[model samples]
Target chain A: MTDVLELRDVHRTHGDGANAVQALRGVTLTVRPGELVAIMGPSGSGKSTLLNLAGGLDRPTGGEVLVEGASLGTLSHRRLSAVRRRTIGYVFQDFNLLPSLTAAENVALPLELDGKSIRAARRAALAALTEVDLADLAHRFPDEMSGGQQQRVAIARALVGERRLVLADEPTGALDSQTGEAVLRVLRERVDAGAAGLLVTHEARHAGWADRVIFLRDGVIIDSSGPLGSADDLLERTS
Target chain B: MSIRHGLLALLERGPMYGYQLRAAFEESVGGTWSLNIGQVYTTLSRLERDEFVLPLPENDGGQRPYEITGTGRAELARWFATPIERTDRPRDELAIKLALAMTTPGVDVAAVVQSQRTAGVRALQEYTRLKTRQDKQAQDDLSWLLVLDAMIFQCEAEIRWLDHCEATILRRTRTARPAEQAQTPEPHPVRKEARR
Candidate 1:
């Protein structure tokens, strides 16, 4: 069990004045290599706040976030940015895409920003698109593509940089059940390829597909269960 | 053993109808495995069609007896020797709704959670009443009263879980997923309407 990410006594507060809201409270978590974890919580339980801190997108009010032995709390902004670019991939519920860019261009953006050659980035981007079965839509812009297609493109972008860590916030939240299942299969394949990923979702079916699921409440984690082998396990765990 | 083979193995002891066969199954397996009577009957019909079992001549006593044929015994032996692969996965609906509620927009996930919680409370109250009645009659039928107790406990556990889910829903308002909401716009209205 090699941990790729770990959070200890993590806390996030929105304000310091009289109107402060504590999103996370002394929360602790860990994600191992090749593990697909689903963090489930009702709204306001600090799920996204925890994700933001873990991904280095936001600073936590307290606690330590260790990514590959390097504490995010100890890293400089530049160092964090570097870690984000190379070690992590993010997929949001909204297919965040540049409407002006094609699917291939969107995928290539990360590699290009990291100083890769345009030709090389484009080639890798195409390969990633193919993995999600959307190579033919590589030239399609976000507006031209269907919601599912756009999400698949987002997935390709996440998988493009050979990132070892993927963070998806409701990746299938925008698709129909059938399409959602298809999108989930891509994430499962990435895990099979040895990437450590954390999926934040409310859907038990999506959580059922993960290696493990953590239920959160009031900024704390509850039942932490095994590689959910089946849907029955999902219902059983919840019950 | 495949379920069918397990059934044949049970039937080999004696001719039995669906309910009797079910009881024999539970006793043989120490009640660890529960089979739906529907599944047993469906398999029995299949076995009869395959000539592994035959419908014995109808008795004037108005009971159907199923006797395993020689071929059925051989087939049952082979089945018992081969482990059956488990292929079906259970689907959890509550998890699906919560996930969608977080990502899907403009729709009140909390309201739906409350609705379910209310229904669960009603069901729990009904189960409590039934359990009380059964307890009072336990002296008349202890065995059935015990079965009712198990069912009541299951229903109570379900209600507790539903209450927990509702409490969680009430405690937080996850920031709406802008990207997910924008892309989805509305939860496939068709599915939502159909569900309603």
Candidate 2:
């Protein structure tokens, strides 16, 4: 199957000449259907820059980014926004829900904005909420729910229309450990169901859910691990 | 991860023989820790000598069961009540290796850090996968979950340390550029092979 997301020799530099800081340096990556890729790095390590480029929110100064096989650099602004809404889903650290909107409405907003009927949008939104096991809470407002519930609502919003590429930046950062794991479990279930996931997190515990991990430093991928065929080797040796 | 304590905790419910104890132990930990019958028997004998348990009459199957004594009950209760301290852990071999790599001549400290980080991340990923699979497939066992959590947390800590080590080395190298330039710099690719 074709990759859902791909970044080829991508570079993003901020500012001009002497003040220019390279946020991404010739980084290449790919996320396929059912694959969850994690980016791990310290602060100012270009994690967000890479994620932004992948999501088409920021353009790379060099090289190409193809989301669902469409080169983002070649698309028009209108087309890109369409792709962002229809192809890629982003879950932020903050739930990013409007305080006044109830959970189902928050999720439906994206589809409604994309020109679907409000009734159809709401039906799809409830289905998405059910995917996250929050169908019963769909009527609750973001303020009425816990942090984890709100994050799930954000996730429901992101992937409401069966978006194949999910980009998350510390989606679990604000919640407690158990709640965070619950949120990740939802993300993992989505990825397992064939949505490619790209997670940017400093926490290894959270990144552990990914099928692969890319370690970034000084704006470059310093290391990436293979199939982890040695997991049994590790546990056996330790025991 | 003391098997003796584990056995005592299990025996608290009822008397169990060696084979039964080993099976129960493996089951509780979700088979992460392998225990042969010898280890189980040895631990039982030790517990017997320590007066923490009493040997019961042989069953019809010729298996001699052991029951936890009152002292063993108290010990198990104490173990459960007492939080494990960091000092209880074994010496960290990864930390020692990184420290040694830093001081050793011609050693690529960055490579060392990266390799360790890769391994650390791999282990963490494995534990996470296992935890998810087990949680999905089996009835939830708190002990098994706790064991997986311990491994996951340890892996996370090691990766974090490796990250810190790499950052510190990079910062130090940038600040002490002149000195580092005078020392062994990374050899050119062509020259590196030629040197060997």
On DockQ, the candidate that comes out on top is 2
| Global Cα lDDT for candidate 1 | 0.77
Kindly provide the TM-score of model 1 when superposed on the true structure, using C-alpha atoms: 0.59
Model 2 clashing residue pairs (backbone):
none
Candidate 2: regions farther than 4 A off: A230-234, B77-88, B177-196
**Model 1: how far is A135 from its true place, Å?**
1.1
TM-scores of the candidates are 0.59, 0.91
Cα lDDT of model 2 by residue, B1-196, tens digit: 6889999998998999999999998888767888999999999999999999999999999999999999999989999999998889989888898889989999999898888788888888888988887787875587888989988997888888877888888888888998767578775788888989
lDDT of 1 by residue, B1-196 (tens): 4678878887789888888888887655424357789988899999999999988876797767799999999987887776655544355677687678768888776566655543443333333334444445655655444544454455446545765777756445343455446676567878898999
Please provide, for model 2 over A31-149, each residue's C-alpha lDDT reduced to its tens digit, 9 standing for 90 to 100: 99999999999999999999999999999999999998899999999999999999899999998999999999999998999999999999999999999889999999998999999
TM-score of 2: 0.91
* Candidate of highest TM-score: 2
Q: Against the unseen true structure, what C-alpha lDDT does each candidate score? A: 0.77, 0.91
